[model samples]
Target: MATEGLRALLHSVRYEVLPAKASEEKVLAHVPRDVVVTVTASPVKGLEPTLDLTTRLAGHGYRVVPHVPARLLRDDAHLKEVAGRLREAGVDDVFVPAGDADPPAGDFHGALPVLRRLGELGSPFARVGVTGYPESHPIIDDDITVQAMWDKREHATYIVSNLCFDPRVLGEWLVRIRRRQVELPVHVGVAGPVQRAKLLAMATKIGVGESTRFLTRHPSWFLRFAAPGGYAPERLLTRARDALTAPSSGVAGLHLFTFNQIAETERWRRALLDRLGG
Candidate 1:
C-alpha cells in the first residue's frame, strides 16, 4: 500500500536530532542537505547548544528548525534575541514545546505565551510548529493538551505529533483534532532505527525520558524496540498509512526522532524509498 503520497512523504522527511555531542558531525556526514534537520533543546544544557547547532547546520545549507522551548527562555528579551539570531542565520521555522524545565527559567511558562510573544516580535518564522499528543501526556490531561492547540492555533503554523506507537491511537487523534477544528497540517512523529540501550541512556538528555520509559513499561512497545534486532520505523509508518495518506488527513510529512542515529536513519529512509519505487 505504498501510495504516491507515502512515497512523497518518505522523499521529503525531516529528521529531529538532539543537540548532543557529535550529532552535528554525524548529520553532516550522513544526512543530505535536502532533508530538514530539527535540533532539540535540552533542559540540562538549555537552548544555547540547540541554537548553536541549528545555526551551524543552516550555515551548511541545511533547512534547520531549532526547538525553542518556552521554559528555557528567561523572558521576552531572551526570546527576541533568540529570534533575531535565528532570523539572521536564515532559519524560517521553529518548533516550540512547553519544555521540561522545572521551575521554568523565566516569565514564559508554556508554549502559548512564547508563541504569542513570537507574534509580538512580528512572527519572524515563516513556519512555527507546536506539539500534539496522540497518547496521554505523563503530566498533562488529554483535554487540556488538545485545548492548548486550540489556544495557540493563530500563532502556530502546524502541529507535530509526539512519538506514538499505536496506529489506532494516532488515527483517532487525527480525527479528534479535525473535529476540534484544528486545521493545522500535521507532521507525524516516528522513531528511527535505534538501539534500546542507546535510547535509554540519552533519553533524559533529550527530554524524552518519560516517553522512553513508557516503552519499556508497555509490552508491545517494549517488544517493538527491544526485540532481537532494532526497531523498523517503516512498520509504524505502514501501519498508520491510511491515516497518514488520506486526502483530508492534513498530514504534511514526517518528523523522525532520530536520537542522533543519523546514518542508520538516513539509510533506512533511502531503502524504504527505493522499495516504494521512489
Candidate 2:
C-alpha cells in the first residue's frame, strides 16, 4: 500500500524550496523542471528574494509556485504588483500562508484576506493553494482553522496540507475534510529525505511553528535525532496510505517539504518510484 501510494504521489510530487542563499542554484541543478517547485517566503527577507528566485526558476522552465505570505505585503497594490510580476514570469500558481510576522506589514493579517484580495484582482493565479492543518494549530483553534479553509475555498483551487508527523491524525483529518464537503484536491505535505538536524534547523528557520511545537512537547524525538538516518519520511505516508488512496479522497499527490535538500529528496523519490515500477 505504501509503495502504491508513493507511486501515485511521486508521479506529480511538489518539492518545496526555501528562500535561502544559493537555494536557487540547487533547485536549477538537481530538481527536474517537470516537478512543481514551490518557493517558500521568509518574514525577515520579505517577498523580494522569493520573487527574484521564482522568476529565475520560471525562466529556466520549472513550474514554480511561490508562497504568497499575506503578512509580507504592504497593500492590495503590492499584491497586484506581485501578481503582475509573477504573470510576467509565467507563474500561474501560488500558496498562501498567514505568515509569522507580528503586526502584519499592511492591510491583510492572514491568508483569507489576501485570498479575497486576489479574487478582487480577477483571480490572477490559475491555481491558488491554501494551507490545511491536520493537527491542531498552536495558536488557532480547530474550528477557526476549519472555517478559514471553507472561507478560502471560494478563491482557492486546492489545498496543500502542512507537515503532519502522525498518520492517525492525518487519517482523522482527511475524513473530517470530506465530511465538510470541501472537495478540492489535496497535495499532502511530508518531510523529504534530509538529516534530522537539518530538518529541525530548517523547520525552525522557516517558521513551521507546528514543527517547533511538536518538538517542544516530545523531547524524546531527540533520541531519534541522535541516531543516523533518524528521519524516515515514509512512516506517516505508509500509515495514511489507506486514507490517501481511498476513492473520492481527492488526494492529488504528495508535496515534499524538501527544505532545499533537493538531491537527497530526489534520490529517495526515484528509488521508491523504481521499486514500485511507477
Candidate 3:
C-alpha cells in the first residue's frame, strides 16, 4: 500500500512545462486533466508564450499555472495587465520567481515585490507560489534565500522548492525552514523522466552566465544523473520520504519538472503510482 505522504503527493502533483512549440500537444496527449500544469516564463520569450500556453491549457480544462517572473514585467501596470489576463483566462494559480533577466525589465527585481503587488491587487489568484531553495542559489546567499521566503510568506499561498538532488540537504532544509518559522506549505521540485544528454545540452544552451550559474548550483548533477543505466526519480523520493512525510515538514506535493518530456514523465508517474498501489 502507498504510504500516506506518497499518495498525497502523487494525487496533488503538478507538471511543469516550458512554453515550447510542441509542449501544448505533448501535454494534451499525455497529461490527465486532473493534474495541475505550470508553464515556465523566460527572458528570451518574454511572458507571451507562457501566457498563451496557460490560457489555452486552461481552456482545455486543465488547472493551469503560469510563471510570473518578477524581472519580466516592465512595471506595476504590466503586472496588473498580466493578472487581469490570467483572471480573464480563468487561471487561479501562479508561480513567482526572480527571473534571469540581467537588466531587469523594470521596477521589480525579485519575487517579493511581485508577490506584494499581487496582494495589493487584492490577491487575484487563489493559489500563489514562491520559490524556496533547498540548495543554495548561485547568485543569492543561502541566508538571503531563507529571508526572502520569510518576507514572501504573507503574500504567497505555498512554496515550491527549486530542484535539489540531495535528500540530506532537503531534510535539513525542512528543519531550517520550520525553525525559522517560514510556514507556507511546500511543493518539492523534482526532475521528471528526462535524459541526461538533454539536460546537459539544455544547460549549455541557456547562455554563458546561466550555464555557469547552473553548474555552480548543481555541481553534483552529473554524478547523480549518471547512475549506470538511467536516473530513477524514485531514488530521491525514497530517500527523502521521512523528511517529506513528517508532519512538521509541511511538504504539500511534488512539482515535477517535465523538461517538456511530457509523455515520458506522465508514463513514469503512472507506473510509479501503480507500483505503490496508489
Candidate 4:
C-alpha cells in the first residue's frame, strides 16, 4: 500500500532548515524526533548560525547534518576548528557545497577541496552529502557540474539534488548518473507544498541570484508556475517515487526544502503518509 511505502520513505527523509533564521527552540518544537534534520549555511550570514544550530540539535538527540559552504571557510585551520566544534557537539554528518558567495574565501573554491580537507581531518561522521543539480544549474555548465560530483564521490556519502520542479528531469538524471558510473545514492529534492505567490515573493526576497539561471533554463515553466494557484510537489514526487521504488534506480530518499514552513510541511507529509497507509 502507499501508506506502507510512505512510512518506509519517511525513515529516509531529511528535512532542511536555514540555520540563520531558525531558532533552536522553534526547530526543536516543530521537528519530529524520528526525522533527520539538516541545517543550511547561508553565504551572506556565514557559518556561526549553522554551528550553533547543529550543536543545539545534536544536544536534543536529533541526527544533525550541517552545511559546510566552501566560500565561508577561511582555511584548513578554520576547517579543523569547525570539525572540532562539531565533534564536541556530538555531530557528525555534513553537506558540503561550493556555495553562492561571489569570491573564494580561501584555498577551497568548491566542495571537493573542502571534502579533501575533511578527509585529512579523519572526522567520525558516517555520512557526508554533496549537492547535485537534477536540472541545469544557474551558474555552472552541465559538464562541469557532472564532473564535480564525480570528483566528490570519493569523499561524499550521498548526493542531494538541488530543488527542481520537473520529475522527468530527476528521473532521467538518475539514469544518467548510473550510466556514467556515478554510483552514489541520490536524495531527490522537493519543495514542500508552497503557495505559488509566496514561493515567488520569498524567492525574490531571498535574493536567490542563482535562481536567474534556473529561470533562464526553464522560462516558460517558471512563468507558468510563478503566477497564481498553489504549487504541489506531488507531480515531482510521483515520478521520484517510481524511480525510488525501482530496484536498480539507486535513489535513496527525499530531502524536503521546507523553507521554514515547518508546520504546513509536516502536516502535508503526515497527511500524505497516512493516506498512503504509512
Candidate 5:
C-alpha cells in the first residue's frame, strides 16, 4: 500500500531550482519534460536569474513555476513587467513566497500583497501557489504561519508544504488545515535523495539558520546521510502513508526539493518506479 501510495504520489512532482547559476541544463536534463519545475528566488541575487531559468525551462517543454517574491518587486511597474514577461514566456503558474529578503526591497511585504497586485494586474498566472510550513518556521511563529495559509486561500490554487522530515508533523498539519476548511490540494514537500554533505552545503548556502533548524529537528535522518545510507524520500512517504491516503487530508501529490542534485535524484526516482513496476 505504501509503495502504491508513493507511486501515485510520483505522478506529479514539483522540482525547486536553486537561486544561483549552475548547469540548468545539467540539472533539468534529469527531470522529465512533463514534470512541474519551480525556480527559487533569492533576495541577494534578485529574480532575474529565476526568470531566465524559467524561460529556458519552458523552452525545454517543462511546466515552470517561478517564485514571484513579493518583496523583490520595487513598485507597480516592476510587478507589471514581471507579469507580462511570465505570460509572454508561456509560463502560466507562479509560486508567491513572502521571500527571505530582510527589511524587504520595497512596499510589498508578504505573499498576500503580491497576490493582490497580480490580481489587479489581471492575475497573469493560470495557477498560483503559496507556501505552507508544517513544521514551525525558523523565523515565523507557528500561529502566524498557519494563519497565513487561511489568509492566502482565496488567491492560491494549491498549497505546497515546506520541506518536512517528520511524517507525523505533516499528517497532523494536514488534518489541521483541512479542519480549518482550506480546500486547496496540499502537495507535501520532501527532500529528494541528496547526499548528506551536499544537502547540508546547499542548505547552508540558501539559509544557514533555517537549514540548521531543519537538521536540528531530524538528527537521525542527518546521521543517515553521514553514514553509508542516505535519506530516502520514500521513507518519509511510507511513514506518512496513512495520512496521505486519507481523503480528508486532501493530500494531492509530491513536491520535491531536489536541491539541484537532479541526476542522483532522477536515478532514485526511476529505480523506485521500476521497483514498484510503475
Candidate 6:
C-alpha cells in the first residue's frame, strides 16, 4: 500500500541541473511540472548560465531555484542586483553555496556571509537552502561543518544534503540532527541511474569540488561501486525509503543529482514510484 507519507515525500522530488546549452528544455521535460528544479552554477560557465536558465524556467511557470555561489557575487551591490533579477523573473527561492571558485571574488567567502547579506537585502525569497554533508567534507572537519549548519540554521529554511551512497549513514545523520535539535527539513541527495564511465567523465569535465570531496571521504565505496557498470541510485533510495517516510525522520524529500542524465534519471524515478504504486 502507498502510504500518505510516501506519496508526500515522492511529490517533493527536485531535479538538479548543470548550466549547459539546451539543459533548460531537457530538464523541464524530464521533471514533473510541480517538482522544484535547481540550476547549478558551474565554475567554468559561471553564474550567468544558471541565472539565464532559471529565468527561462521561471518564465515557463516551473518552480526554479538557482544556486547563488558566494564567490561569484562581486559584492553587496552585485548581490542586490542578482536578487533584483531573480525577483523580476518571479523566483522566490534560492540555494546558497560557497562555490568552487578558487579565490574569493568578493567580500563573501562562504555561504554564511552571503546568507547574512541576503538577509540584509530583504529579498522576497520564500525559502533559502544551504548544503549539508552526511559524509565528511574534504577540507572542513566534521566539527566545523556541523557548527556551520548550526550557524546557518537561523537563516536557512531547509538543508539539502550533499550526495551520499549509504542510506544507513543518511538515516543516522537524520537522527543526529534531531538529537541536536536542528529541526530544519532535509532534502536527501541521490544521484539518478547513470552509467559509471559517463558519470566519471561528466564529473571531471564539470570540475565540481564536491565530487572531489565525496571521493576523498568515501574512497572504498567509490572504488567498489563506481566501476564500469551501470549505476543505479535505487539501491540507496530503497534502503533509505523506510527511514525517509518515518514520521519522526524529518527528511522531507529527494534532491536528485541528475548529472545532466535527465532522461535516465526521470526513467528511474518513474519506475521506482510505479513500483511503490504511485
- Of candidate 4, the 10-residue stretch with the lowest lDDT total is 205-214
lDDT of each: 0.87, 0.83, 0.89, 0.77, 0.81, 0.81
Q: For candidate 6, write residues 22-131 as lDDT tens digits.
A: 68779767777788899999765678888899999998889999999998888888898899999999999999988777677778889999888778777468899999
Which portions of model 6 show Cα errors greater than 4 Å?
Answer: 1-4, 207-230
Would you estimate the TM-scores of all the predictions? 0.92, 0.90, 0.94, 0.89, 0.90, 0.91
State residue 234's C-alpha deviation in candidate 2, in Å. Answer: 1.7
Lowest-sum lDDT 10-residue window in model 6: 213-222
Candidate 3, 184-232: lDDT as tens digits:
9999999987898888877675556767767676777777788787778
Kindly list the per-residue Cα lDDT of model 4 for residues 1-278, writing each as its tens digit. 43354457666788888664545666678778888888887655678989999998899999899998998898889988988899899887888988876676777787888888778777457789999987888668987888888998899999999887766777788887877878898887878876656655545544466445334554644564665564677655765676666656776778998767677778888877776666
Which 10 successive residues of model 5 have the least lDDT summed?
206-215
The lDDT leader among the candidates is: 3
Model 2, residue 241: displacement in angstroms? 0.9
- What's the best-to-worst order under TM-score? 3, 1, 6, 2, 5, 4
Q: Candidate 5 has what TM-score?
A: 0.90
Off by over 4 Å in 5: 203-230
Per-residue CA lDDT of model 2 for 243-263, tens digit only, reads 888866788989998878888
- Shift in Å, residue 244, candidate 5: 1.4
lDDT of 5 by residue, 2-47 (tens): 5677688887677787855674766566788877888888776788
| Cα distance off (Å), candidate 1, residue 142 | 1.1
Supply the global lDDT for candidate 6: 0.81
| Candidate 4 lDDT for residue 142 | 81
